[model samples]
Target: MSAATLRAAIAAPAPAWGLSAAQIGRAATLALHDELALAPKPGLVSFVDSGSHDDMDAHTFMRSLFSLRRYFVRMAELGAAQVPFAELERSGIAAEARMLAATGGINTHRGAIFVLGLLCAATGAAQALDGRRDADAVREHLRRHWGGALDARSQRAPTLPGGIAARRHGLRSASQEAALGFPVLFETALPAWDDARRRGLSAQQVRLDCFFSILAVLDDSNLAHRGGLEGLHFARRAARAFIEQGGAGQPGAPAAAWSLHRDFVARHLSPGGCADLLAAACFLRRVAREP
Candidate 1:
């Protein structure tokens, strides 16, 4: 063998544990892809349907994904550097601007940029330390390290639509979810995903189950914002009924879900908060798969 070939053979193996910034970013991107690919999601844009959105489609989401990939990596790097919450938010703001520009000023993945960005940072911080990449470890680190700052952010006066709607409707805002270290993402959505997997559900079926489960409980401000209190309640009831019927795993569940999707479109309702939680669940599932 040549000298170079011999050196290549003797190179040290990469660590089996801990994710680098690039890995974290890639995982986040893949999670976004997974969310976008899940079809027949009620009132949410997917590869196969626009679902109550006229400004965007699967292509728009793809562009946003391309724009935000490096942002997730940068956030992960910042986490490894132990930056403050303000710094993270600043980075996220810049990333959101890029996303908007890429999608021609239409809001696509705005919620994901916020929630998933923090998750990327938290994952980096967890893995950067003793390589403890578990979901509980990352969540604990997030709450222990930045919980105060997040709670403070939640107290700020409402500016965005989701926040305004949440305040008016007395529902928990996305900022509050971040402040509370995303209890629904970790405690609710992730477990539901795992349960669906264990029960031998298909990929699409698992995502549908997870989405309906989140919708049943989440006071989705987007639904309130678009459809009012009556619309929100109606959405929750519909989701609860679907989940009660064994979600997409039961016979005829997919057809029922499609019917509900059409109803949501007809009513101009969107469970955007539940969609964000689903993205977070996908991200956490990727992180959990490392071990």
Candidate 2:
């Protein structure tokens, strides 16, 4: 879809989904904030530092988030109306433009805009269908409604840096992951988060553990783009070692994570894909808990 078409869609009257759209949008925004506030996230931006990215910071992220707030709300409205995938794709493209403008052309939350945007849309669609807002329902609705589109999108030629890196290295691109209903977010990250919470870890620890769990397995294109396949494998190994040592439940776990963060920064390796999935997991968890 063209930018002009997206503007036309924005100008049109949006269907009312009551407070549901607003609520889902807020959840998506908060989920990004949740990811941002997490400190010592290896090779990712946090409130304390810019991680591997010297070009952007927490302030940049906040600006991007502010610009995207309404985008997510509109996505929810579209999902509730069961608009076609092309409409949602255009909305996301528009949101990405707003984010880049907000950050002076920096790409802070493009992945979040794509991942969380879809989840927010799915959440709205699920609610509209049967008032089901659980993670499973959201995933099911996303696949049922948009899975074909995502799968088709996955076959397109590489454009973004991440997609280019994925193709170059034979790694699964984000679109492929999405078409598979985000198996890493749904199967891996969320389960790791649940286990951490079940073990009575602190909120920060739970998130940190979940982050590491995702880094351990995700074929993060950001890592591949920055540090090549070697760097990606090194990051996965480091993350697996962290988990093998009892994760965030062990003493000095925070310190360990900090140490890994330093190493990742030194290596200039950023697991941005993992970070996006972590935010998605956080969004799902929040949505599930919302009344």
Candidate 3:
């Protein structure tokens, strides 16, 4: 479908959301500015869109995957420093890491952004790109971590459901090898499925490809999980107020100034729904724009 058509179709059904897609769009735009030297934190809950023609391009898909992987690593790093040694609960980073580890091991096939980033970076599409500093570095880093490269790991193969998503789409994970199966259902799995369906690739593929494809984004770590936890030394009681408050509206409606994040989604986000980060901003945009 054409880009314009794609936009309309995505906008339909829920022209009104709980927040501004533009707010998250701003975050994405800011990330592209490249000033932060950190991965972009567009803050859209789910960005992978399988139903939208514009978003299904392999390149765009790869970048979105890459972006999420980078963010996961960055969040882990940032939260780690916040961890307080004096008290086990003091460090935000440590606590988050621990939580992730407890929930699922970090750097594991399911828990690792490194594995996903490495896969995208290694792809022919990624290699063909001109300015892929992040991709390039990630590939090299994965190589060092794994006998000079990241490949499928037979040990952590996804379950029947997880395997179906990656297998159906011919998707490969950097950390996972065809030899070993990916074992568990990673958190990023669900979001990946929604993105694929939204992008319209659902028909072409089956089984969700949650292990490595855009579906893998659910594995992409964020501060919200840790932020939601209690006993954080700093930024405690966030209430996840940032995302929760986001509201939505119908097309052409007047947006109230609920929050800045709303506008951020409208301008930058595509119709990723709640499976991606744009959902948060879009919710806000809809809230502000709606009467």
Candidate 4:
């Protein structure tokens, strides 16, 4: 590393975090690549953070960026597949609570969104351009269909109509969804979810409908971002600072975290979740693995 690079790294606001836009771009690449399993194990990528465990902002921002990208990938993949969600599930993943147990606590909504969005994006629903631009269309296809089911009252105390919201003992207060006895894999950042009972939808229907709106909003936001994509430049020195000072590569410290991240992409980061992680991982892997 050059003296200038070191100086810049030292001067960065979030020196511990490796989240400059350029690095983010790199993250997007890795997230996409990893999602596709094209070039796996991209190695340790870094971002700046306060080392605080209180919030999901760090991961959330990254996931949002990546997920949006993956959404497009999902659309592309769907164009080639001739099956339903059940068929997709037959060869795909169902959450393994034990496997995720090691992660301790995390903002599941943010983290899961990152993972799920990537998988979804990879499946060919990415960009959502084909979904028809009008929100009413999405509402017709996604809203009224499932949202109405989330309003039923359940006997469980901490429950919604079709699902229950509970704070997992050892984990961060992340919401889980189960329908007809199976846990579903998607989540949304929507706020009204807490009032599903009043909304006239069952927990199962609420879960599905929430995902629909989440995807639609994410897609719309992502398309706007993409319009300015090429013009978004990464400052060379800023890029260098992020990569060098990022806490992720401080010697052998990140092996476990890196391992988990690699595993995470494999297990989660599905059609709707991991585009950002894949792209980021790919970019970092390319940069690191290069001679």
Which of candidates 1 and 3 is the stronger one according to lDDT? 1
TM-score of each: 0.93, 0.94, 0.23, 0.25
Candidate 2 per-residue C-alpha lDDT over 143-219 given as tens digits, one digit per residue, 9 for 90 to 100: 98999999999999989999999999999999999999999999999899999999999998999999999999998
Which portions of model 4 show Cα errors greater than 4 Å? 1-72, 79-82, 87-131, 142-163, 166-291
Candidate with better lDDT, 2 vs 3: 2
In Å, residue 170's CA in model 1 sits off its true spot by: 0.7
Clashing pairs in 1: none
Residue 157 lDDT in candidate 1? 92
Order of all candidates by TM-score, from best down to worst? Answer: 2, 1, 4, 3
- After superposition, which runs of candidate 2 have C-alpha atoms over 4 Å from their true positions? 1-19
Candidate 2 lDDT for residue 8: 54
- Higher lDDT: candidate 3 or 4? 4
Model 4, span 1-291: residue lDDT tens: 344653443244322321222333344444433433322122112243212222433344344344344333332233123223332232223222221332333323333333332233222221122323122232232222222221221122443211121221211111222111101222232332333435566543333233222322232111122222111111112222323443222344235334434542333222222223233223322322322
Each model's C-alpha lDDT? 0.85, 0.89, 0.27, 0.29
